[model samples]
Target: MAAAGPGQHPGNRARLIARFGPMAGPWHDALPTLVDGLARRWGLDVGEAGGGGTSRVYRCRRDGDHEGVAAAVWLKLTPDPVVATQEAEALSAWSATPSVVRLLDSDLRVGALLLAGVEPGTRVRESGWRTADVARLLADLRTAPRTRTPLLPPLGERITFMYDMAARRGTHDPEVLAHGRAAALGLAGTGPADGLVHGDLHPGNVLVGPGYRLVAIDPRPTFGDPDFDAVDWAIDGATDEVALRRRIAELAALVPGMSAARVLAWCRATAPLTTGAPAFLVTPAGLRG
Candidate 1:
């Protein structure tokens, strides 16, 4: 699907300012020059635009390569340079993990990243995700950095932010607040920062890569229990206990060091934090507060 280039896409400019505000005004105003500079600096022949929300990605190729000779690449530019720096750190740590896209080069000064474009580039949401593939992607990301770094904060912090935002928006379901809010809060504070996680590994963030393998992209990198990453996958398109439990079982069995019980708890804890809770979540027992 072709996308409208920057400043052309409807509402994208407002969303951009709303997301980064005046702090990034200079960068927003200089987008064209930035793209040209990046193309020259990286020896890329910039092509069409793609990706949305918080970043803009352009499909491009190396300087003299034709379509069939050299692999195409993506230029991911972010409104916030900090996000680029942090993701650069996370991607470097996971460079050996084939499930992640290789970060060819990054210019943090301009909040831009040159990333390897996936073959077939089909989003999992479009192709459908298999539990085993999802688990493999999760397991591949379980690598723990030798020393804990601030680049990866605990997954709970991300959850807290989501919960706080939901609360601010007054979007919580009544039953959810009555039953799941306590669960969400408790889960937010649970655990040691054990391993690396693609903190926001939703279906849209995944794509089919070479050899028909699933490749993860745009990680909201975080640490602590890999199980936290499983919640989104477990609940995606799952509208009942039967479906969700089945996913939890499949993912737990395949993901190293993960358990069905933990994944379920995380789901129960987070179901309310998210706006659309599947009908079967029913709020765990004793979570009243």
Candidate 2:
């Protein structure tokens, strides 16, 4: 996918400050040193990678190795320890799938990873992505074998919290939270026949290569019905009612036995809960936590 451009989306430092207030003395003093130590230990030549609100990913190259042999690893730094660990475990599990990025190494203690970077391609936000590309990638991701890992908390819990927040904070949207709650309950008892799910499958998460071969990154793996996994893409970038409805229909058609109405309900219900909100306000890690 196209590399994230500079100063676009949300800034990582701004996100940290907004979420946790000002950085404390110890954490501020230690962060740069810790990152530098990690780079030296891993033989990485570090540079900036595009990022969003919650995490900042850095492009890294291993020293002494030629560019071809030096792996292009991305380091995602987050203040929330739980978010980091969840991403590590999810990536590790998805690594077993051939089309997904392999997790070469990770330190849950420090929330760092060494991953096999896919060749540069068009991100879903870029012009080249087609519906067929997304379809193929989702198909490949769904083929990964399932394991007995604990599922994330049900959508109901998150919806309930959203509703509660709306009532208490006077800033919550009742209709949106209600739609999410109903959809969550409906999905609670359903899942694909058997396989691992890329919990957050959106166009932005898909990487399209020559002939539009798809490789997915930033997965949130879970053991559940694969059909339930299309919600993220359906609601992504939908600003108007007509566009939103159409995208929902398009995505629902991609997964057999899943209806657009159901997916739309779920999307409306869950989007606010899943976006770059504070962890105390929403469930950031999905089924894993």
Instruction: Compare the candidates by TM-score and give the number of the best one.
Output: 1
TM-score of every model versus the real structure: 0.87, 0.70
Candidate 2 contains a number of clashing pairs equal to 8
Name the 10 consecutive residues with the lowest summed lDDT in model 1. 1-10
Candidate 1: regions farther than 4 A off: 1-7, 64-68, 144-146, 174-182, 273-276, 282-289
Scored by Cα lDDT, where does model 2 land? Answer: 0.57
168-244: candidate 1 lDDT, tens digit per residue: 66665566654565565576567546677777777788889877788889988777767777888888877877888
Model 1 residue 235 lDDT score: 84
Candidate 1 global lDDT: 0.75
Candidate 2 runs further than 4 Å off: 1-11, 17-29, 64-68, 151-172, 190-195, 235-289
lDDT of model 1 at position 228 = 78
Clashing pairs in 1: none
* Residue pairs with clashing backbones, model 2: 1-121, 1-122, 1-123, 2-123, 152-287, 180-269, 191-225, 192-225
